[model samples]
Target: MNGHALVVGEALVDIVRRAGSEPVEHVGGSPLNVALGLGRLGRAVQFVTRVGADERGTRIVEHLTAAGVALTPGSTSADRTATAQAELDEKGSARYEFDITWDPVEPPMTADVVLVHTGSIATVLEPGCDVVAELVALQSRTSTVSFDPNIRPALIADPARGRARIERLVTLADVVKASDEDLEWFAPGRDPLDTAREWLSRGPAVVAVTRGGAGAVAVCAAGTVEVPAVQVEVVDTVGAGDAFTAGLLDGLWSFGFVGIERQERLRDIGTAELRAALETAAWTSALTVARAGADLPTLAERVAARKVTR
Candidate 1:
């Protein structure tokens, strides 16, 4: 509610294949999910992404529109919509095979944006990745910048180059969220907490690491706070992290920790405030894992869940 958010990344259709079942398609992508999640939480948000001018592309737009997310100019591509083939295990976790294109034309920026979010393959992909990084850098001076390096090792052609690109974005971000798996893939053998701390020193005010069912830990100049995961029946962990990122942003914004006016205060946020934010993120992630695909909770659902928790 402080101001609008701009989310820049890929928007793709997920073709999920379960044993003895036909492939089910769902509109998804890390950044796109974050954008939708934010919109559902009643934030004014704009999604800037690339998709084909096909049926799948129309579905993605419809999904965003239904979630109250606005599409930026030139979000549709003339190429075919990107697709990810997800093979689900008995545990409902997925292994992905992607056929996607990510060459986007930069869109015009809106004046009311106070937060800019981008990451995943869109930060390391190609010509589009550079544009995203440039936008993040430009927005860092004026708006709070959040990043999620939802690293996909299979898609990266050059690991070293990808790491460098991620590092550069980290230097410009105010908030950074990554999973334990992402840290392991990015810096094998190094402690993830150490890496998160290192990222904090590079520039980010806070670096949050999600540790699957084990829970999450966040580090900032104030110190570190850990929150245990909310127990729930596992469905598919498709957009759980993206939901967490959205919830974290919402929590921060609600606490008056966003926008140009409050960007500097992010570094010195109190431990209680940080924990509340992490708990909000945990609850949001729990909601996603409870449902199928990357389905996130609405603001009303979140409020009801909180009341139940109390």
Candidate 2:
């Protein structure tokens, strides 16, 4: 609630096993990370998510409120708060096992520049998906909708149903973010960019496919461009894509990417702005993964970093 840009999905506490035994709890969820990312970038952000009415939920609320993002009452309750247990690899990548009640709450209609949904597991988990889909549809008409189908293959055992739901979401979103791995989970045979084109045709004005080290691509009706990754020493890829999403949103504002009300304006926004938006996204993401935690650098920090001449 404040002005614009709502980030919707789960807000869970991640218990990362730092070395493989000691678990460290951090407030995270892809959408929640994006909300924090946006908040750091000085965007007026509202996080619409559901968490159990418990100690962890209260902590998440307090944390987000402290960060300056307002929360509308999350639409679900559980005996315990949602949590993810991460099994880490030698390189710092993680495979997660999630527990707790998953619920999604949609806030009443509010004026905003965009509404973003990510964390596919959270969105498709249960009763949450139906409610989240409805909220997405409601905002699709008057606002820009962004989707990051951060798919976890183990969760979506049915490939066909997974692809179908992904397609349905494409129709409801204005922008989509998917890593190559995410594309592979949905449809194995086709190329990721090919799949992205399919999504573009479905509805999204632009589709972003992020390549961990290779960089990212922005495919749109305007045109397609590949933005190189900012080479930085990696700690982990945690919340990097969420930071990228925040970068895209802020880039749009900086590039004078204005209203979606007019057709021409929308097209211009899709074609002309995506590449630069993605550039900013990658830069911001670099700063995030280069650091230890999920908290992305603010706009001022980004600008300052860009200014320092090596």
Candidate 3:
């Protein structure tokens, strides 16, 4: 809680269309969701992204501001805000087509930033991806770096090139999270946990893979720990993984594992602690899925849900 979080990536509006329902617009983007989630959890958050000075950009800023997230200067300099068309199936799962630009506002290098999070399009797309990687590398010296591929196959022009960039970021990150589907696409026919272990060996202190409905498993120095999913009524799966990432980071912060000073402790975290963190993350994702769009729960809401369950 004492450490500040800096989230850098894309922020776009999702134009969601569900069959038998009208299309809806929601301000979202993977890293934006994470930033908002952390802000709602009462974490000090600073977000950097490119959004045009348009209505959609205004909505995005209002959403972040309402959640208590600060927008870094120059974040709204893009010529036009990006958009993603999310088509939802009967099962509430979504498939996306993006019209996004990867360029992001550069954040000043500061000593007080204890955690740096970046991923998705910001890590693989041209021009900005390289900047994000370099920023992550520089931040790793003084801050804890967290990453999530959140791979959108449609956005990746070359699987090989994208995989290389992702792996390189994994080596720079202290914590990494990916979905089962993402892993399947990254390494066909391979178990997600195996990939988690491999990523852990590369550099990350914690490598977590989320399996929708089934649950999530994580690998750390102590070994692997798995947690069951929290049951919730389906709404739509937008920002679920980002919620998980935010919750995971929040749990780590609460456990004193989110700063450079605690990097070694994070590396040595035990299975029991990892399990508790993952359980919280599962609850966070469950709450997001139970709601429409990327509406995440606040800390009070998450705690109250746990209380009611107990």
Candidate 1's C-alpha runs over 4 A off are none
Query: Considering lDDT, where higher is better, how would the candidates rank from best to worst?
Result: 3, 1, 2
Writing each residue's lDDT as its tens digit, candidate 3 over 1-310 gives: 4668999899999999999889999999999999999999999999989999999999999999999999999999999999999999998899999998877767889889999999999999988999899999999999999999999999889999999999999999999999999999999999888888888999999999999989999999998898998998979999999999999999989888899989999999999999988998999999999999999999999999999999
The models' CA-based lDDT, in order, is 0.91, 0.75, 0.93
Residues 58-113 of candidate 2: C-alpha lDDT, one tens digit per residue: 88888777667887764335556778887667776778888745666567786664
Leading candidate by TM-score: 3
Best by lDDT: 3
| Total clashes in model 2, counting residue pairs 3 or more apart in sequence or in different chains | 0
- Candidate 1 worst ten-residue window by lDDT: 103-112
Clashes of each: 0, 0, 0
**lDDT comparison, 1 vs 3, better candidate:** 3
TM-score of each: 0.98, 0.91, 0.99
List model 1 lDDT by residue over 180-290, tens digit each. Answer: 999998889999999999999998888999998999999989899999999989988989999999999999989889897787798888788999999999999999999
Ranking by TM-score: 3, 1, 2
Task: List the candidate 3 regions with Cα displacement exceeding 4 Å.
Answer: none
Model 1, CA-based lDDT: 0.91
TM-score computed on alpha carbons, candidate 3: 0.99
